[model samples]
Target: MKTKNIIFIYILLLSFSFAQSALKIATVSYIKGSCYIENSIQDKSITPLAGNSIMNNDIIHSKEDSFCDIIFDDDATKIHIDENTRVKILSDNYSRVFEVYYGSVFVSNAKTHIKTYIQTLNNNIYVNNNNIWVNSYRDFDKVVSINYNANIYNYISNSQIILKPLTAYNIFSNGSVKIDNNLDLVPDYIEDESYLQVRKENRNKYDVYLNDYDLIPVYGRETEKRSFDDNGFKLGLTAGTRYMNNNEYLTFGLFPQYKHNNFIVYSKLNVYYDYFLKCSSFDDCEFTESGIYSNWESKNDILEKFHLRYHRSDYNNSFSIYAGEIPQVTFGHGYLVNKFSNYYEYPLRSDFGVNIDWKIDNDFLNFKFLVPSIREYFRDGGIFGMHASLFLSHRFPLTLGLGFVMDFNQFSQSPRVYDVDSSIDSRQIKAFELDFELDIIRSMNLDVSIYGELVGIWYPENIFYFRSDGLMPFSDDLRWRRGTWGVMAPGVSLLIDNKHEINFAFNFNSAAFYPSYFNTNYLYNRSLYYLTAQPFDFNTLGFNLVGNQIGMLNDFAINSTNMEFFVPKELYPILTNKINVFPLRGFSIDYKYNFRNKIEYYNAISVYTQNVGQEKIKSQTYYTFDAKLSIKENILRNLSSLNFYVSNVFFLERDDREEYTFGFNMMFDLPSDVYILFDIGQVFYDVSLNGKRNNVLNSGLQLRLNF
Candidate 1:
């Protein structure tokens, strides 16, 4: 009787515990410092604990019982997490993970880890409101040790472990040790030593992955060549598919060039598919705003999945460019601006036609051939637009002129639309553009861009005369005429920058396109209508500079780190709370040129934060300079072990910028096809681009396979 009673109570308790554990699916849990949704009413309610969720910018607490699955539809990404890990759930959107202070999450590779230490730097680093530090600064090729208070242990082959004070260890790697020194190998530990940067074999022009490897190449450079040193040129082709944020597309292109020392000839072709017209398919797709802009395949992002490309060539990256018509800037671009809600840019362009690119920036004069339209000439199907023509003009960071246009255009003359008005002048519209600009402040970089265009049109029948701009329309019968010409208009732009910043420019066009209404059979409160025919132009906001005219919310850059910001391991976890603004991470400032001081500057304040309390938000930020310098030492000469890279961040939304990022990274390379990769991203993901947040992760790896 007693045994039966005991068994009954035991079974009841066990069932209760299991039920409680299942409740976690409904509750929230965290991985590394990233957020994850435990369970939603719509889900099956059973998942792994380390997976990412679908919500961002929301908070959730840990419930020891929660479990979630992280299933990225596209497997182009990997994830990592750290130990003793504790971070609040900011957001866990499957594709867009974002958070503040979700320290120590490294993402890359193809797989994701949970609750693991950062493994990139391969050393432990600590951060807080005060300083930075590192652990056992040694080389893995040799032996290194952690002198526990009195006792000592040895590790062989090195099992790069993220150890903290009072951690116990058995045997695992080349050697073993019993940690007892209250030592905590942190990510911020730093050691200074000189190393050699031996020069390797010279990589020739054919050595790059530009397509054909067996061919020699040559290109004529004007002043400054691109990131190339060899003179020979090779054919470069690329076909890639980008799937990030919320858009997807496939693109393929070709670049053929001949180069010498002071001159060059090059032409190019590129085309792509945007797949479908969804709101989320374009760049800068957002939640607010309305019109066809809203309905046109609205999703998380907006993109022109499909575009064309062509170009000539130029040596100076500053001026003198030849790729496609639409100015060097208008070629192959979806637009030049971000969506009304989020800020982003379309990365490529299709220069309307082909043209010649010339330059005079670097002492010598240079020239290159911009390919003309071969598509229309080939009768490959039926390509009627601009004739395959080349552009020709002078050069200067601010100088500009006009170029002839004979390119192919299909989107227009929408054969998709028929007006029976098939006259030579009315049958075709050749594209042409005249451009000009002024450079006001070259230092802080203050400049304005202006350009105009004229197209083919017909009026007095097929009798040919210069149609206003002398543009002759291609008649179906070979001969051409005048009269049928499109409207003429102009636009303008400006730009600025720093190191980390690739570029920053604003453009506006007055009536680039017409108020295009995507009126279709799908009737509703609003049709996917484009207020302006032009792409992303400032004119939407009244700037009127057609084309892609975008306004940068903020443009700053953080290039390289001083490479010195870590504490020694002997101190263990004592100073784990210190943080630095310019250590492993980079930093840049925003500034305007000051004449008297002859300098550009930004706010001198940098804030650092640390998690002093048990809560994630317990961390606080304060501004300060480093109180200590890394001492140069040669402790471990031949042994390498753990590495850590860290960062942390806080966002003051009102400021429209991130307060700062404070964190670390660590990585390890082991024998065989294995590597340990780890990193902690502090405040890496702040604003939700396209309504999505970029969250930081603490990722660790067991091995890295080089294959």
Candidate 2:
């Protein structure tokens, strides 16, 4: 008797071991079209096949026209997925937990005592060995369970419903709900005969994948899911008419895009023509030369922006390469270079380059080589730069980089509008920059961060240019000097959710740092030194302070400048006998209030005092104030809107310098695929020399469509 009992115990222990070894969470029973499994632990996607094991935290994605079937090992429960769906496994232990983020899914547990739970954004459905079909769209959800009962809980309203078998329920994102007993004859939940026929035809293929391929799914799907324009093309068009300052023009634009796998190609083209319909040539149009129309300028037919890009992601690492007419976008405190749009009109700004980015782990590497002008080649000048940064912690990142600008014509441009007008020889500049980024605070409702950068530029004969006397041509004591100077800026930002925030920054420049040559403060476009003292050859030792705040009700900004001391110099012919200097001081503040519904108000004031060539002897001060009010309302249900705006500008010291403007705008989105917008305004400028005020009509109409 003792021997028999011992044998029974051994057999039971061996049976338990076998059962544990065979227990799989779930299996990929069938797949149609394209599907993939994203493993959370591995941070990668794996091609799955029939009989493939599903693990905890696995995300299943089905592309358009695709389908997948999953069967649990413990209870033999089945789940059928429809096209464009994502399901995540939260807990696959005893009682299963699943989240269906989009599309539709069908779950069935024929046997009693089996448990299943499915969660959506607003509700939770629990199946006590029941069968259910769920469909989730943008803001609407539907569920139908046949042959078995289920329980559902609304997370938002704390409501519960015991869903009986053969019934349908509708759940709205806005917290409304309904249930009905009648079901559709061809409900989307049930597998149709067409799909079953397809399954029959692919039975041999699935069997091969399960038995011969060892449950490894075929590599037909290139990515984990399908992109919007995957292996397809899209096109967009924008046409408009604009009338500014009594000048009118018609604008047309086209944006086309195409994507294939990990590759993308896109272009933007724009054309502008005179509204008078008399201008034969695009360049001959008066509006083309106005410079106010910055979107695009027609060269021959239109402006074209063409770029080819390749992007790939796998295993937590990503890489992207872009070439051809790329935008020059700089990040992480533009100490070295800023996009040309910051300083010039967009139509004149051109950049053709190759950009490369590679990110792995916590480190990122970036490189850029751009040509500002294609006709002039490298001699016309271009920028070549490389940058690297690493995240030391989640909230703190450190970065350092070097950049070089090849310039053979820095001082050779003809004197024109917005020109710095320097006589320095062809010179190249090499710059080095360092940045420290820190996130000081992060909470559910608030976030704060600080960023600082130190930058220096070096070049030959960068300072102390020679004074040419014409006869001798140059003075020995005033010869060029090679030097380096740095500019430093420290900025802090605070945010209370998305609605409110504040930012403050202070910039300090050393005396030897020349703004005209380096264009410091590229981030703000303020360039106080370049604007005031660049032409006078005056150097500065001062700081500029800027602050901005955005609240639920209003937005405000303050820009202050004070160059207390300057390097004394002689005014060409006026102040040669006495010490010459320039003192710069200015402050500007602006405020905007948003009622969050239909009304907005804005006001701005500025005061500046710029002293040149003997401060107390020659000085000037100016003041300006401006205000605006805007009101808007919805015209249709997310289909249209209308707005009215009024504005006034006043010059305190100049008589008849006040200006006023009023405008109305309308936007229409009645057609789902296109948008139309129109604006009309009248502007009253300062009094003309004829003792009469000048007024001009401003109007614009634009239509945009995408496919």
lDDT of 1: 0.26
Each prediction's total of clashing residue pairs, residues at least 3 apart in sequence or on different chains, is 164, 0
| Best candidate (score: TM-score) | 2
Over 1-707, each residue of candidate 2 has an lDDT whose tens digit, in order, gives: 99999999999997765554334578898998999888745566888888889776678999988989997664346788888899886542345667899877887653322246778887788764356788876675687765444567777777555544443567776656665323342244353411222323444554321111111332332212212224788898988877653457777878899988789898767665654544669776542354344434344113226667897643235677776554545534553443321212222233335666667632344444433333223334334455565555332433344445444433222111122233223434566666655666543235567766566666543243323223332233243334444343466656543224454444443423322222211211111111222122222213211121011001100112221111111111111211111233444444555432234565555454544443234444544454555554331333356666443321324432223345677776644468887877664421122323355466778898988
Worst 10 residues of 1 by lDDT: 516-525
> Which regions in candidate 2 have their CA more than 4 angstroms from the true location?
1-231, 242-248, 252-254, 275-305, 309-315, 320-328, 335-357, 363-379, 393-408, 411-427, 439-450, 459-484, 489-501, 512-668, 677-700
Q: Across residues 1-707, which tens digit of lDDT does each residue of candidate 1 receive?
A: 99999999999997765454333211222343333333332333333344334332222332333212122233322222333222222222222332213223322222111111111122321111111111221222111111111111223433233232112232223343333222233221111110000001112332322111111121221111123233466565545443322334444455566666434555443344445444666685544412221112322112222222333222122233332232321211111100110001122211123334444432233333443223333322222211121222212333333333222322222111111121111122233433333333222123333433333322222321111112233122122333223222233333332111121222222111110010110001010101112323333323222121121100000111211111111111111212111111112121232211112222222233332333223333333111111111111211123222221112213221122233333444344424444333333221232222244332222223432
**Per-model C-alpha RMSD:** 33.1, 19.2
Provide the lDDT at 498 for model 2. 26
lDDT of 2: 0.49
